[model samples]
Target: MGNLDKDILEKIDDWLSSSYDEETRASVQKLIDDQAETELIDSFYKDLEFGTGGLRGIMGVGSNRMNKYTIGKATQGLSNYLIKQFPNQEIKVAVSYDSRNNSQSFGQLVAQVFAANGIKVYLFNELRPTPMLSFAIRHFGCKSGVMLTASHNPKEYNGYKAYWNDGSQLTAPHDKNVIDEVNAIASVKDIRFEGNTQNIIPVGEEIDPIYIEANKALSIHPEAVQAQKDLKIVYSPIHGTGITIVPKMLASWGFENVTVVTEQATPDGNFPTVIYPNPEEEDAMALAKKKGEEIDADLVLATDPDADRVGIAVKNSQGQFQLLNGNQIGSLLIYYVLSAKSDLKQLGNNPYIVKTIVTSNLQADIANHYHVAHYETLTGFKYIGELMTKLGDSAQYLAGGEESYGYLVGDLVRDKDAPNSCAFLAEMTAYFKSKGKTVYEVLLDIYQEFGCYQEKLISLTKKGKAGAEEIQAMMAGLRQNLPTTLGGIEVKEIRDYELSQTTDMKTGRKSEITLPKSDVLQFITVDGDVISARPSGTEPKIKFYCSVKGTLHDKSDYLSLQNTLEEKVDRMMKDIVG
Candidate 1:
């Protein structure tokens, strides 16, 4: 450990002298004795800051890692925040954990710290989905909540997602304030790891019934699901927490012919079946698609590790199983919701739809077809939740979704709930089947009614410290040298969300954008194509979202039109980067 600073060296020494296990101490000692400069530097570089996604890192023993000490400090900070927020009342908080490595232990640590601070804690008895934690916070009338999960990250990671009483993740002043408290806790000694056993409550069946009943209430077409009760649906959880309740929820929705992918059904943190447990990953859904093909199922749905995001596969025009991208699924869900509500004459004139700025604009097209309002917020489910809170009383929120496969059916819960989405998606498939059409056919019909909108997401990951700097520089370069055109089309409007302004290149006219400032840039072409560039908040990567649209005159031309749109997206990306 040559050239190691006194502070880092002393921190390691303190861990060695503290109550940390012997194995962790021995690993630190071995690194010190071997003079492993790189390992020591990486381990002791800096404390892992509570990011937008809360504390997420590889499970290990270090200031920058996710371990008992870090989790404890975070919980203590949250407990402090809760106390400050609710000074007079008796504060209670709900806690849940996913099926990740160390998730349960970390959850218990949180509950213990909260209980030690004289706060009531309702901790889930075992592994549970993240959305249920969100739901429980509102249902149990808690002041705050914490979910122990790394979301769709790999097995080496774990996380803590802090929530307010609104059932959404912290935002604005609260998020920064909680971070300040966590940062103020400079030492593990500041954390209270012991608890009054009476204050820590383990919750399971008592709350399960409530969550399932609420999810069932989100069903837009129970009669449709009842009619198509035997609709063949293949489901998988990708070895995460979804399997616990998703199948049961489907059965309750009257879908009796659901097939669970046995290989990926069990909850294992190792995620032995796939490299990434994220439903966005094709490898994770390969088995489900295989089962779909064998059984000729109507739809194949899989949720992410925490069950917050759901991805589905539908048979295309050729009767081959094809995965619908996040944008496609978002459009279909929005289309069905809006169309069904309009058909039933249940839509209020003040009804509105919410979607993240990064999501497909096809939703906007559909919303316009029904004369419903639509609003776009920053790139987070929390912002959508905030809007729902803001407009809950005056304007009705029909539905909202993001480009990342997260959707909210109603305002019952404040987060993207896969359990509810899974049931609703199954109902959508059945509804189309009742109308003598496949889900793919409904999607095509929507496209034919609107235009054929195709979207592509390209994420370029820049890992580690140096990669972070590189990404920053790239964003700066784009802002400095804004492109005048893309894909041979004139860049008519440039929407710079950071500066909260839209500039017309030709007229040199600038106007204000009213949404919250984010590091996203959108270039709209004269031919009605959109290209957006944004950097990831939680991870070290930058993503570019490209959208191109055209008309599909017939179902036979779907594949050819899709290919053209793909080419348009590719050319646009190249022009922007080049």
Candidate 2:
């Protein structure tokens, strides 16, 4: 305790004296007696902030951790904000949890807090996908919702995603206001722990069918699905929530030959199969890939713990299984949706699609080809959902996705829906199979039409408080000393999202960037290469996204051109990030 900071010691003392539970106090005392300086500092250095998305952190007995007390405080604050926002009206909220270690308990605590505060609660009986939680918000006419899952984070971490009435995460004023409310609670005693059993309701059986039916309705080619019903598809949930609904949705979509990777079929918080349950990682999909190889499957799909994002593997030109990046998958999904809508004459006026700023520009080109308007938002899926709500009736939302293996079709749910994406992916595979082609073949065809766009994301992880400062300093250094040239190409323009301005390097003319202010910088080169530098909002890392475009006159030139682009990206990353 002598080595600990004076302020941190005081905070620990407060926790010991406060109305915290006996277990929490004992844990705090043990840390103090054991002189666990690092753990003490990390756990109580600062309060776990309720950011725009909500709280996420390692689970422990600390103010900065995800625990019963922290969860209760967040819920009570949300309860207060809801009552203020919806005065006199009956306030309703839905709660759902993933297969994380204490996600179910935290979710129940959140529901109890809402119920204790006189707000009606509709809680899922078991683990469900995060998108279904979003769907339940609208399905049950609830004013808000909470999803308990760390979403692709490691086993030690957990999170809470707060949703609004429109089935989207909180944005703008609500996000800030909720943060304010959460910060106002001074002590644990301020939280209401007792739940009103009458106000708390169990909701799964009735909501599941409606949600599955909604996803099933998004299918465009029922005939193609019937014709290619035996399309061999391998799927794994990676011991997450996807197992609850993915197979059921696929089967309902007429996929008769779906094979589940039984080893990873059960939902487990420990994620026993992989290092990270994220579908984006190749190692996480190894089991599913093995299953696919055994069955000679047409496609392999895997979803993260919350089932909000999906990663896919398909046979390449050499007949070897290759994992398609998020951009490739998003481009294919949008392309399929747009082309099918056009073929069916469903391209109504004001047809639009959405993608994040870091996503591939190929989506914009595809939207242009089909004459559909495309919008780019900030990095989070909530921003896409916010755009959907803002465009309520004036524009038709065909589909939207990000470069993080998340896609949504027909705007049924405001958040990313992996189960829905899986269904549509299989359907798209079936449709292509009817044409004697594979999804990979369709992707190559797309590149052949629109210039091949290659994108790479390099993330540098920096852990602990010092790492956070290092990340900030890195961003600051780049901002202060802007790069004039990258990979021997002249930097044509610089878009400083934090400053909300774009400066032309040659002309020195400045123009305002109309997007919301964020800590991101983009360098546009004369050769049409775009390099974006932004720190991850949810993780302890900074990411550099590089995209290069080149003409693919012939399919044979694909590999050579891809190699050239990759070399260029490596050079650019070294020049800028180093």
Candidate 3:
């Protein structure tokens, strides 16, 4: 503690003397007395700034933490921004939280802040999914909304995701503008802490049926789902908000043999079943997969804490249950929607699909096969949502997703909708099953049509301040020393997203990239393989996305080609990162 900088000491002292509660002050004092220098500095070094995911951080008592004061200050800042954005009108916001520690309390505090600022607040009576919160904002026609959950992060963390009236998360100008308002608050005294009870409306189950019905309408093949109504489906909420509505939504979708993973059906912030609540991880989906095997289920679905992301396990050609990666699941969903629409001759005018730049290009190929348009955005669902909003009623949005288990079916909810995706995914499985085929066999068939593509994601986490600096240095090094080849293949071109240009290695020709500028770099080999590198917006890590493709002319050749592709991805990753 004595080694702490003078400014840090001042910040700590201010917390002790300010209107901070006794418990918070005593916790800071204990850190000082215990000579916890690292913890103190880590806790007081800086405020948690908004990123692609809004305000998120470890839950504790500090400016850098996701505590009451921080959440309150953020909400107040949002209130100020909303007032300025829509002047002289009654400002309204929908508020909800996930099943995380202190999530409900933080949500209540946010609602109170908005209410105290003379804004109308529609607060959920209990914990709910982030997608539902997004839907509520649009359905109620509110000015904005906020969801309190750390997403798939560890239990020690909590976060706030602010959304606009379109039900999408904040984008440019608004995101930074809200932060500017937050930075203007010099003290906790500046925040409107007092609540206007009348403005704070407690909303309950009345909105549930409306949201469920909207999701039910996303089904494209209702007749097929009805035919295979007993499609042995297993679901696990991963101890998050999905339990609130996912099961009911499945029932609404006409799935009769749905088995909710009994061990993890409840919404608990502790997330005791798995180390990480994210369905993207294999461990998190273990229970669901086990139940799928025991019950001989056709599909297994697990949603993250906020229900924005989902992971599934389907039987492979070997009759063994395997957890499909985000790219696989996303491709399956895209193929299902496009193929169905094409067969039904219902390919709406200007129908299009969207995916992140880091996702597999197989989606683009599938969309092309059906003569549907496909677009790519930066690696965040917010950007996808922004594009959907930008397109509006002009273009029909079929589906969109990222490689992180986040996916969306219809345009109704502007975020990745787990329950909706589950319904659609289950329908996909059932559709193929009705044709005497499994989803896995259908996936192989897809590879047969469009060349087989395998993708790999490697994330190197760098935690704390020093780790952050290390990540920055790593990115700099990557940019400075551009590789000329990968996996023994000549690098044909380089696409530097930060510079918003693509440079051809052979001719040194340059072309401007149209998407928003981001600190990402891509290497395209002469053989059409692609590898991208970018730092994560929400967490302290840098990630590399490698995709390699090969032709699969026969079903029996699937495993052989996939194995070779896996090796190719491994070599490419080693060459890029090492």
Best prediction by TM-score: 2
What TM-score would you give candidate 1 relative to the actual structure? Answer: 0.96
User: Which candidate model has the greater TM-score, 1 or 2?
Assistant: 2
lDDT of 2 by residue, 247-284 (tens): 99999999999999999999999999888999889899
Residue lDDT tens for model 3, 1-578: 46678878888989998589899999999988888888888888887776645798889877888898999999888898999989999988999999999999999999889999999999999988899999999988899999998899888889999999899999887888988888898899899988899998888999888999988877888988999999999999999999989988989989999999988988888999998898978899999999999999999999999998999999988789999999999999999999998999988989999999889999999999899999999988999999999999999999989999989987988999988898899999989998999998888888899889999889898877777899999989999999999989999999999999999999999999998889999999999999999998877789999999999988898888889999999999999988
Which pairs of residues collide in candidate 3?
Answer: none
**Runs of candidate 2 exceeding 4 Å displacement:** 1-3
Tell me how far the alpha carbon of residue 415 in candidate 1 is from the true structure, in angstroms, after superposition: 0.6
lDDT of 3: 0.91
* lDDT tens per residue, model 1, 413-496: 888989888988999999989999998899889888899999988888786556778898999999999998898888999999
TM-score ranking from best candidate downward: 2, 3, 1
For each candidate, what is the lDDT?
0.88, 0.93, 0.91
Runs in model 1 with CA error above 4 Å?
1-23, 33-36
RMSD of candidate 2 to the true fold? Answer: 1.0
